[model samples]
Target: MFFIICVVLLLCYFYMRPTVPRSPSCLVGKTAVVTGANSGIGYQTVLNLASRGCKIIMADVADMEKSKLDIIEFTNNPNIFAKHLDLSSLKSVRDFASEILKSEDKLDILINNAGIGTAKNNRTADGLHPVMQINYFGHFLLTHLLIGLLKKSPSGRILFTSSLVAFTNNLSLKTLNFDLEKPNYFDRHFVYGNSKLSMIMAADIFAKKLKGTGVTVNSVHPWLVKTPLFTKIHAIYKNVFFQMYIWLSQCVFGRDPWEGSQGLVHAAVSRKLKNATGKFFGDYAPWRKPLKAYNKQFCKEIWDASEIYVGLTPEERL
Candidate 1:
């Protein structure tokens, strides 16, 4: 009887998984900046914000023309514009932030959704690890640089795109060197996980820093969605027997990009969660308890290390 009840409850939960609706209420008269907006989860998130009347700024490393075309296909709204941002490059992040500052006075929502998960063990133009720089440090720089603009809004929200891998993958700060030092393939998972862990820590630090400033900061684990972002991994892993494993895993855990982005949108606009700052959320609710390493001291250390690595002190950026 208990087993049957558990099965019924599980079935209901799957049957009632909440979908991201085109609600006109969440984003009326707002200005939102979304990174990696050209494709995957970022693309779906951009569409969601735009559908509710938010003026959208789509930033990505991809060509502006390509991003613009994608936006056109997704939404015919002219309020949307595309900009260039290579999150792996500190200079690129600075340049993109500068450009946005020149054009927009205030930013209501800044979604740091751009990320890379390839196993190439690469580095950016900057000498930092490619995944680390792109996933965490870049967003760190961008957010700090634009905190003033975000604070210009009545109540700004900074949403970071973190992942569940942070809890599962092992990391050590000694292996901080870039592509040349790390494994090119199998070990890429740890790098990805490290970057995401850094992201969550950064978000927590930002939230604490902006406590009374009305600029809330948070991070989310958008589910493992099957998007073009995973094409490389999927293609590489899709062999005769691996395909079945991938399929079964995805069936149980993966979701579409739109579904994955719900937590982000919820965190971005939900007034009921006004006190949700600094908290890590997944599937649109506060994570029960963050990993032990996600404590305040770690966040501060990561912040200091990041500032040192990026050569931008908090006062200097201000």
Candidate 2:
């Protein structure tokens, strides 16, 4: 009986996942930026906010013309625009942030949502782990640069799309330097875990840093979804057997992108959470604790090191 109940519960968890309710909260004059807006949950989140009449900026490494047109057509909300952001490159991140600061007076929402599932050992032009840069450090820099603008709004929001996989990470200041050095036995299963954890750690830190600014920093575990993220990872391998493994895993663990994005939209616009910050939200808004969510000293050490890694100037320090 216990075994049957466990199986039933798992099935229900997957199939009966809640959708983010339509938020009655008004966003008439707000402007939001979503990285990874080219596809997956990021795309869906953009659509959700656009429908609510928030001016949307679709930022991604890809050419956003087609996706932008599609969202505009569907939402009939013409305020959506596209911008380029290549997170793996520090220069690109700075350029993007600079452009935003010069053009937009203030940014109301910032979603650090671009991510990948690749496990290949590689370093970016910035001499950091490509995965870590794209998933965490790049956004860290962008957020610092844009902190001023976010503070302009009475209740600006900065949401990081962390994952349950973050719980699996075992990290330190030393291990975090995976740009040239690597974590022991690094592979696909563990490649993305640490990056996710770093994001949550960042949220913990920022939630404190922005305490009096009325700027909330929160993280959400958007749940597993077989989005093109896995499809892109599949292209990384040539062996038939490896491809099959990837496909089988997604088949068992993934949900639709729309469903996976529910937690994010809920975290983004839910009126109930207007003043909430430093919270780690799970699928559909259940509170999920972050890994070492309160390790302030460790997070600060990593933050200082990250500032050096990202080449932030003294004046840029927040």
Candidate 3:
């Protein structure tokens, strides 16, 4: 009877402990830039970082005037500002980078969190698949353009928003280029998955390349959070499988945007993670990889392929 009572009390204590969420303190003088910050994961991440005293730069495709107001309202910090960025266009990325270079010389954090999932059969101004362009290549060029600024920070961190779909996507040399003649129409989830896989591979290669530069790169699975990106897909497609997925998301797997942003925040600010580089993380710790992420030949292939697809030669940073 005594032991049973003790176990019951322990269970009650464990259940009623009122777990405290992770809310780290002030960044003070540091600067953080989050892409797609108008809503969803990006917006929450911006606020979370701002709460810690980091000067926040919010970049997105939305109207800057309204977004600025919203961010100001959300953060109530004068340090928060919005920049117009359309990641679909490489030129837009270049122009945004140029503007940022003129304004801020150093960036402590670069969260490549802006992306599109499955969009219609369209191409960017750069003549690439809209999904691949916005999701991977755009972030690719943007990161390179800002590498100089990120490197200026004492312990710079670059975070990529990868997805579990990365494992589900089909990737091939042919698909990397939008080969219309290939007889395969886009599978929205698969394309998104491929882009995410590329992102993970890119993050790994990027961290390896920047080995001595004090810049750390990591990719994250933010889990299934409800965001506007899903609404863009066709209803018929959404009905087949995505609806059920979203339902499951609502029931069990989904997180609020704020909760989803925690892993990114932890990666950005935690001193404990200073040495944790060139890896994937989720749920706020070094991800338990089913297999080791490092494969010299595969990594090299991905780097080389990405470089080709983005029109970047090995010698060129942009």
- Candidate 1 regions with alpha-carbon error over 4 angstroms: 1-16, 19-26, 64-76, 176-186, 236-244
lDDT by residue (tens digit), candidate 3, 1-318: 999967775675454332224546568899988998988889888888887778988999986666666766776777888898998888898889899999997999999998886665656678788888788888888888888998899989999998877877666666664545333334666678778877888888889888889999999888766677754543435356666665644445456687778778888888888877887887665665323135567657666777766666455652
lDDT of 2 by residue, 1-318 (tens): 999967876786667555556667667799999999999999998988898899998989999999999999999999999999999999999999999999899889999999987646678877888888898899999999999999998789999998888878766786575644443334544557878888888888889888989899899998778789879877976779878877755665667888777778777777788888988888656476654656778888888888898998999887
CA displacement after TM-score superposition, residue 311 of candidate 3 (Å): 3.3
Best by TM-score: 2
How many pairs of residues collide in each model?
0, 0, 0
Clash pairs for candidate 1? none
TM-score per candidate: 0.87, 0.90, 0.86
Ranking by TM-score: 2, 1, 3
Candidate that would win on lDDT: 2
* lDDT at 72, model 1: 61
How far out, in Å, is residue 240 in model 1? 6.8
TM-score of 1: 0.87
Model 3 Cα shift for residue 245 (angstroms): 3.7
Q: What lDDT does model 2 reach? A: 0.83
lDDT of 1 by residue, 1-318 (tens): 999967875786586466653333556678999998888788888887887778999999887676666666676666888888988789998899999999998999999998877645466668788778877888889998899888898889999998888875555455444445647444676777777878887888788889988899988988778777666666655365655766655665678888888888888777777667988887777784346445666556666778887879658553
Looking at model 2, residue 229 earns an lDDT score of: 83
